[model samples]
Target: MRRLFPVTDQTSADRAATAPPSPGPDGDREWTFDELAEAYAYPPLAAGAVWLRGNMVATLDGAAQHGGRSQAISSAADMRIFGVLRALADVVVVGAETVRREGYRPARARAAFAQRRAAAGQAPAPAIAVLTASLDLDFSAPLFTSPLVPTLVLTGAAAPSERVRAASKAGAEVVIAGEGPGADPARAVSALAERGHRRLLTEGGPRLLGQFVAGGVLDELCLTVAPLLTAGHAQRIADGPELPVPARFEPVSLLTEGGFLFCRYARADAPWISRDQG
Candidate 1:
C-alpha cells in the first residue's frame, strides 16, 4: 500500500531542508503492517472521552454489500486493515443483523498487536458488542459462549426478560442502552465508554452505522473504496433517517493498494487530522 495524500516528501522537506532528499512518496513499495497500524492509530482522548469510528467497504458504484454480505465487495488489503483496526480497538460495536449475516465471531488476540494492547491497558482481545432490540439471537452461538472477552449485548430496558436472561446465562453481558425497544446510538457509546472501552470501532451493517451518524456520535470513518461495480440494489455505507443538515467530514489520510482506495475521514469538528494537513 502507498500513501496517496499528505505526501511524505513535502512534510519531510519542510521539516529539514538540509536533510538528505527524503525518499519521495512510498511509491511501489508495499507498506508493512507496522506502518498501517501507525497510520490508523486512534487519536488521543481525554479522561472518560470516547472516539467512535466506523469501518466499511463499498464498491465504486456505492454498494455496501453484494448478495447480502460485505466480504464480496472487500479485498485482501481491506481485510488487512480490518484486522489492524480490530487490533487497536477496545471493543467492536456492531449491529446484531451484521453479526448474524456475517457469521460474526469473537475478536481474536492478534500476536502483532498483543504488546500494543497490553501497553494500553486493554484486554487480550477486543470484545464484540452486538446491538439488538428484541434480543432475538442464538444464545447457543460461540460468540456468546466462547469469546476471549465476554461478548456484550446492547439492548433496551424494555427488552424481553427471558432473552436477557438467556444472554446472561450464555455468558454475554446485556447492557441497557435505551428506555424503549431500540438501543439509542448515543447511549450505546456512553455505555461502552463506561466499561472502559473508549476506543470504539463499529463494523457497520449500514443501518446501525446510520443510527450512529444520525445520533451524531461517530467521530471518524474509515472507508475502503473497491474498484469493482455491481448495479444491484445494495445499501450505501450509511442508511437511516436523513439529517437536517448533512454532516461534514475532513479527510485524515488516504492509501491505495491493488486498485482499492482506503480513506479515513474525521468529523469536521474533530481535532484529528493528517500530520501534514495539521
Candidate 2:
C-alpha cells in the first residue's frame, strides 16, 4: 500500500472509520459513496438470481465505443464512479479477448474497501476472472503474475485440462464454471454464489453482456449513458440478439453526472420465450 495513492479524506478518524461500503456502480447510483455498498447486500427487491449489471459510456447516438475503446466517453466524475464500482466488486469477471485488448490488471486502489474487507475477515483483493470458451490466454502478462490475488479462469468441461493447469501455473485460479462441454452463464453465477459471492459485477464488451441478458442471469442492469456522440463503428451494447428473458424490468434509480445518464434496473421475472430460437 506504500506505493498507492492515499484517500483524499483520511484526515478525520471518524470519517475514515465510516468511509462507507460502496457497491460498484461506476458512479450512476443515487446512493452516496457509502450507499452503493448498501445496494450490494440489499435482498433482491425482485426476481433475478444474479445481478448482470453493466457499466459503459455510450455516445449520444448510443455508440458504446468510438475507437474500439469507450475511453472517449468517460468523464472525471465517471472515472470516480468506475473506481467505486471496482471497489464494490468481490471479483471482476472479464473475457480473455477483453483481458488482452484492455491492458488488463485486476487490483485497484481502494484502501478503504480493503480495510473494510479486512474487518469482515475477507481478503482485500477481488478475484479477477477471465472467461474463455477455449482458454486461449496470454500466460506471460503481469495480470497473471500479481501474487497479491490470483486470477480465476472460468471455463467449460471441454476446456483442455492442460490449458487450465497452465493457467494455474501462471498464478490464476482455474475453476470450471460448469460441468458441461459449453459454458452456462447460469451455472457460472451459481458457482460464484456457492463460494459466497452473492453480488457479482460484470463489465462487458457487448457479446458477453448480451449473453447474460439472453440467458436470464442478469439481475440488475446499470448503464451510464455518456453525453458525447461518436457515430462510429464501435459496437452498440443493446444491438446484439434480442433477449426473451426479463421482457421488462423497472428502473429503481437514475443519476446524471459529467453529462452521463445513469440508470438502474431490477429484473422483474423469467420472460424467456416459450420456444427456443433454435
Candidate 3:
C-alpha cells in the first residue's frame, strides 16, 4: 500500500511543512490510519435536524452484489472506512431487509475511536436504528439485547400492533415515524435528530437508500468503488422509482487504496457545500 502511493524524501518534507502533523505509521507515504480518519471526518452538527449520510459499496460495473450480498464485492480498505464511518456517527440507520439478509448486529465500540468519540462528546458506541414497515425484525437477536444503546425500530404508525409490541417487549425502542406503509425517511431522520443524534450514517441495502434519495434528506454519500467487475444480474446501490429530476451532488473528496476508490458526495443544496466551502 505504501508503494501504491509513495512519497519521496523531498515530498515528505514539503507535506510536513504544509499539512498539520498527523499520527500514524508511514504518514509520509500512504494513507495511514490517522490520515484516513482525518480525511473522512464528518463536519460539526448544527442545531437543526441531523445531517444524514449513506455508505455503500459497488463493483466496477455498477453491480451492488454478486452472490445475493455486498460482501462478495467488498475489500479490506472498504471495511476500514466502514468502521471509521460508524465510529464517527452518533447512530447507524439501516433497513430491516438489510438486517435480515446481512444478519446485522449491534455496533461494538472500536478501540481506535475511544479517544476520538469521547473527545467529541459521543456515546461509547453508536446505536443501531432499523427501518421496518412490517416490523419483521428478530427482537430476540443480540442486536436488540446486547447493544450499548437499545436498538431503535423505526416503523410506520400503521405497523402491526403485535409486532411492535413484541419488539418493545424484547428491549427495543419502537419509534413510529410515519402513518403509511413504511417509515418515511424524512420523518425518521427528524425523529433521530430530535433525540440529539446529529451525526447519522445509513448503511443501505439499496431499497432504503432509494427512499432516502427520494426524500431529499441524504446530506452526503460515501461510496466505495470496488475493483472487481460482477457481470451477474444485481441491483444498483440505490433502487427505487426514477427520480423526477436528476439530483445533483457536489463531490467532496476522493481517496484511493489498492484500486478501490472511496468517494464522498454532498447534496447540491446542503450547507457544507464542499471542502473549499469548509
Candidate 4:
C-alpha cells in the first residue's frame, strides 16, 4: 500500500539540540519492572507520550563483542529476557543490517504479548519495524510474508527506485522516514511517534543506537551484561568520529543468571552520571 505521508527528505536528522531527560525512580521508590509494567499498562511504554527503550548485550569487561557474534556471549536466561522485553513492547524497531546479520521476525506472542495488552485494553499484536537507508528487504522472510499484518519498513530519501518497487511488490508497507549522510534515527523515531506509536523498543545494531543517542531519542536502555568476555575483534556497534560515548546509566535494577548480569538503565536519576562528574 502507498504511504499516506511520504517522506521526501528522509535522511535529514530530526536532531533537537536539547537532550531528552533521563528517567529514574520517583522519590524513594525504585523503578522496577513491575512499576514500569504498571505505568506502561497498555502493553509497552504507552502512558508516556514518547519513550525509547533499547536492548543490547554487553560483556562484563564492558565490551559489546566477545566472539564474532553476540550469540557467543548470550545464555538461555539472557534470551528469555529478550523475549520478555519484546513481549512488552508495542513496536519492535531494528536496523536492516541487524536483520541481515542476527535475523528478525515479528516477535509477536499473540498469546503472551496479547494477554498483557488485552488486560490493558490494547491490541493483540505489535508491529515489527525495520529501518533501512535502502528499501532492500527479503520479502520472502516471515517478517514480510505474513499476510495478516504488513511489515513497516522505514527508509531514507535516497532509496533507489528499483528497491522501493521491490519492497512494495513484496507486500511490505514502506515509509520513507529519515535520511542522513548515513542513518538518522531521530527522524525515524519521530516518524513512528507521529504514527501513534509512542513507546518504542529499539533492538539496535549499534549504529542506529548511537544515532538515537546522538539524536536524543532514547529514554531507557535494557542491557544484559554477560559474565563471559568475548576477546574477538569482529564486532561493530557504532560508526562515528567520536565512538564509544561515555554514558552514565542509573541502574534501575540488576539480575544475575548463569554468571551473567542483566541491568536496566534509565536516563532519569542516573547516579552514575554524578559519579562520572566526580
Candidate 5:
C-alpha cells in the first residue's frame, strides 16, 4: 500500500504495534486495525444533536458501483475500516433499498470491539435503523428479527398499517417522524437522538444520501476512492435532484493503501437548508 504523503518519525513501539509492515516506501508507516480505529474515531459530540456521517466508496471515475452493487468495487482494507466504523457507531442508518440490494444483516458484536463498545457504554452491537416510507421491508429477514438490538424502522405516520404491524411483530421498533408518507430526514435524526443514539452512521444507496443532503443534516462523508474505473452508467456517490444551492465540504484527512484513497470531508460552516423549507 502506497500513501500519498510521507509520515513523520514516530516511536518504534507505536510504529511496530500497528498493522503488518507495508512492502512499499512507507514500510514504517503501515496501518494496524488499532491505528486505523484511532484515526477514524468519531469526534466529540454536540450537546443535543446527532452527528450524522455517511460512508461510501467509489471508483476512480466516480462510479459508486459495478454490476449494480458496491461489493464489486470494495477492497479488503475498505471493509476493515467499515467494520471499525460500525463498531463505533450507536446505530447504523441505512435505506430500505440498500438493505435489499446489499442483503444486509444485523450488525453483530465483533470480538475485537467488544471491550471498546462496553467501555464506551454502547450496546453489544449497533442497532440497524432502516429508513423507509412505505415500510415495505421484510420483517422475517435477519435484519429485523435477529439483531442484538431491536432494529428500528424510520417511517412516517401515514405508512401502511399492515406493514407497520408486521414490522413491529417481527421485533422492529418502528418510529414515525413525519405526517406524510415519507419521513423527513431531519425529524428522523431527531427521533434517533431522542432514543439516545447520538453517534449516527449512514451507509447509503445514493437516494437516501440525497435526502440527508436535502435535509441539510449531513455532517461528514467518508469516501473511499477505489483505483479502478468502471466506465458505464454506474451512479455517483450521492444522487438527488438539483439543489437550490450547492453545499460545500472541506477535507479533513486523506489516507491511502494499495492505491485506494480514503477521504474524509466535513461540511462547511454553511447553514443547512432543508428542501422542504426552501
Candidate 6:
C-alpha cells in the first residue's frame, strides 16, 4: 500500500523531517492498483528475448508454506499483487506437484487487464505451463480442457510415452524441455519463448524455483515477507542442490502494507564463480 524504497520527492528526507509519520508515503491515501501495476511493470526487452520472474511468499521465519499451503501465510494485499502479476505475465509456470496441491484451475480473464492485454498483444488470460517429468496429472481437469489458452506440459524427451499421449489426448500441448526424465529450467524458458511467451512468471512451490535459481535463468524475484513467524519444519522459498556460490541479487523496490514487506530483487550484474573457478 506504501512505497518504502526508491523514495520520491514526496517522501524525501526534508519532507519526512518536517512532516509527521503518515500511513503511506502520500499521506493517508494508499496506492491504487494502477499505481502498483506501473511500479511492478516488466522492463522492456528486445524482440524474441525473455524475462523470467519468480513470485513467492514466506513467513518471517523463512517458511514458504504452513501446513502444505501458502494461502495460510498470505494476506489480501499479497493476493492482490499475485493477481496483478498473473495479469501481466504471458505464461504462468509451475511444477506439477504445486498444481495438485493447489488444485490448479484455468486462469480467468480479468476485465481490468483486458484492455492492457489487448494493447500489448497478449492473450486474454496467461497460459498455465506445468513442468512434470512423469506427466502424472489430471488431464481431464478444467486446467487442461477449459483454459482460455491451451495449457502446456513441459517434460523431458525420455518421459513415458503413454502419459504424454494421454496429455495430448486431453487437449494439452506437451513440450519436450530436457534430455533426461525432467524438465530443464533454462530449456523450458526457451521453449516458451519460442512460442511467443516472453513475459514469464513462475509461482513456485520451492523445488521449481530452486531449479530456476540453479539454472541462473531467473531474472527477478518478487517476494512477500509475511509478518508472522511460524516455527516449523518447512521448505524455504528455494530448495535444490547447493550452488557453487550464492548468486547475488540487488534490491530493486520495496513496499509495505499492514506489517507485510514486499520486496523485489533483480539478478546482480556481476558474474558468478563456479566451484572449479573458486
User: lDDT for each of the candidates?
Assistant: 0.87, 0.62, 0.81, 0.62, 0.81, 0.86
RMSD of candidate 4 to the truth, in angstroms, is 12.1
lDDT of 1: 0.87
Candidate 3, residue 159: lDDT: 92
How many angstroms is residue 86 displaced in model 6 relative to the true structure, after the best TM-score fit? 0.3
Summing lDDT over every window of 10 consecutive residues in candidate 4, give the lowest-scoring window. 1-10
Where is model 6 poorest over a 10-residue stretch in terms of lDDT? Answer: 269-278
* Residue 47 error, candidate 5, Å: 2.4
| TM-scores, each model vs. reference | 0.93, 0.76, 0.87, 0.74, 0.87, 0.90
Point to the candidate with the largest TM-score: 1
Candidate 3 residue lDDT tens string, 1-278 = 33222233436565343332323344224555556777666764445657888999999899988888988888887888888889988999999989999999999998888998898888989999999999887888999888888899999988999999999999999899999857988999999988878889999889999999998888899998899987978989999878899799976556677888878777776654222311
Candidate 4 residue-wise lDDT at 99: 83
Model 4: which residue pairs collide?
Answer: 10-178, 10-179, 11-178, 11-179, 11-180, 22-267, 22-268, 23-267, 23-268, 66-230
Per lDDT, what order, best first? 1, 6, 5, 3, 2, 4
Which ranges in model 5 have alpha carbons more than 4 Å from their true place? Answer: 1-30, 270-278
Which residue ranges in model 6 land beyond 4 Å of their true spot?
10-30, 270-278
Model 3's alpha-carbon lDDT is: 0.81
Compared with the true structure, what per-residue lDDT tens digits does model 4 show for residues 82-102?
A: 766666666788888778777
List ranges where model 4 is wrong by over 4 Å.
1-48, 179-183, 236-247, 269-278
Clashing pairs for model 5 are 1-258, 19-32
- Summing lDDT over every window of 10 consecutive residues in candidate 2, give the lowest-scoring window: 1-10
Model 3: residue 52 alpha-carbon error in angstroms: 0.7
Output the better candidate (5/6) by lDDT.
6
Tens digits of lDDT, candidate 2, 22-97: 2333433344555544433323312233344566667778787767776777776566666666676666767676
